[model samples]
Target: MQKNALKNIIYSIVLLLLVFLVYLYRKDQPITSDNPDSDVFKMVVSGQTMGTSYRIVYLDPSGRDFKQQIDSLLEVFNQSLSTYIPDSEISRFNKGDSLVYESKFFFPILAKSKEVYTNTDGAFDPTVGPLVNVWGFGPGGASLEDSVSIPDLLRQVGLEKVEFDSVQVRKNTPGIYLDFSAIAKGYGVDVVGRFLESKEIEHFLVEIGGELMAKGSNENGELWRVGISKPDEEGAANELFGIIALNAKGLATSGNYRNFYIVDGKKYSHTISPFTGYPVVHGLLGATVVADDCMTADAYATAMMVMGTEKSIALQKEVEGLEIFLIFSDENGMIKSYVSEGLKPYLSYAEQNKPSLDQ
Candidate 1:
């Protein structure tokens, strides 16, 4: 995969248009001002991590600088879970390490992966690593298009085949590998979010690639506004899916539109189905999921894309703390949209009253 391919695959779901929000903050435009004190100044930070870029904006009421701390924390996080890092814990495990000790950063995502795996009926799986590799999405570019039978790799791929205690993780099948790429970015956002809160920073926006979490309000004291870019367009300005308020909530979007390939006139998406061991071929173009935390939102967004619009909306009714909006092409390949009741209020605001961005 190309360096930008992974970023595109993850971000195809949502784009946190911080550029618009940053404009509002920099101009000191009368946006939303929930804060009474004008002593706060905004610190905008950007850096590279996990093969993608990250941007953080926060109200720096105190004079403390957290750039170094943020860097160090992400470094540790990469060492623990990054698949590109050869000696990283995840890479080591994939290379058949039996007793690799877990990191504080690793356990939570691993545990959460299991939770999402079960909840989505295995739609969101970490153990699909082998399947991912066989689909040519992994490090080595390999594809198993010749055989109609499910490849041997799928036999080794299942969350049930992996076991973990507080101490360590063990794979029942040696080939069983854990891939947190789908979830770790959101976890990273939460890690930074926690650090910001620890330092008494109340309002901030943290986004890695496109996965994001926002707390409190922008400088205008109103809720943080974010736009979800339309999935079907390429380079014609941002025809947004919708603009919505994000306050103290994590939002994640996942889609197959930008991260798919064509073979024999059939488009194969990066979203591999855990059950069929093939890239998802569906009408569900994209899904943007909102949850109390970014990790949960991230997993569900990917799952919803796999589940398609109907199943995702059905799942939303049963799952609490989730707000979803799905975009799909109908029978005639015409654009149609769905917004769960949970998400309607956030996108209901008018253009002028929107917390960020003029259009």
Candidate 2:
């Protein structure tokens, strides 16, 4: 009887110890990894890319050095996308290679380009390269001449002239060159953003040239803030039109004021109309677009420039996931502005219309 009692007591003791261990395990569960407050340290990385500069800020408590890896990755990225490089996939394709080929980066950019191309009604044609060259903005472009043939170039500038699938890319017509410059910088920003993410860095801001992609929060544990430049030609440097609180968003700006020429009392912008076969001449001074991805934002920004003020505004109203701000001149050349309803919360101030160009 005593032996039986001792066995029962031992079993009970073992059961209690097991219960205590499980309780201890439950108490030791970790906090959520998605918490934004834990990543306070930031590592900044910058380099030249796509004929422009790139900047990346990411969180890393390990102090890991990714500069070499980043440089190498960007170098290969340039090789795949840069038209300036004669041997690049894009360059070779432009030179008349018919194969789509496999690439981690080129295909995604091309797919996004096609998506924007379709949605924008050819307003964002990458095949406008031939026209871009004629306007003195692209490789082998000449100085603006009084007389230049445009109708001939229009024949080659349609996005429909090119076709691509997962395994193949073919141009329906000869001389249909593709130029992704409008969206490539934004894609570069995304590339860097993905690189940071792959390294398990959760909080990051990536900017290449003027395009940007932001994820999570900053060191302040607040949303990442990005500034849009005022369209003021006479204002001080770094003057902001307004600040945008960016969280898991991509931003891009397309402006005629930045890359245009005044010749013989006529202004010629780099943005060309595929339908008109000429540089866009419209009331739009600039367009800022926010999208789910930087590539879409960049392409839409350029497309909106081609669509002009009214069309773009209409587009903003109908699009489900786009936010935009437009700075344009009215019929009297008076400066005005339009802001999407979704973008109002992001603006730092009231963002009323510009006083006047004279101001």
Candidate 2 lDDT for residue 160: 79
Compared with the true structure, model 2 gives a TM-score of 0.84
Off by over 4 Å in 1: 1-37, 142-149, 233-237, 348-359
Worst 10 residues of 1 by lDDT: 23-32
C-alpha lDDT of candidate 1 relative to the true structure: 0.75
Across 202-247, the per-residue lDDT of candidate 1 in tens digits comes to 9888888778889987766778877765566353225555676886
User: Which pairs clash in model 1?
Assistant: 13-253, 13-254, 32-220, 32-221, 33-220, 33-221, 34-221
Best by TM-score: 1
lDDT, model 2, position 286: 79
List, residue by residue over 1-359, the lDDT tens digit for candidate 2. 23333333333222111101000111112222356565344567767777666667766766566778888988998888888899888888998848567467877888898888888888998999888877666755444455767887788878777788777689899988888889998888788788889989888777777788889876556788776666654443255566677869998888766555545566567788887978888888878899988888999999999999999989888777899988788899876777788887776632453333212
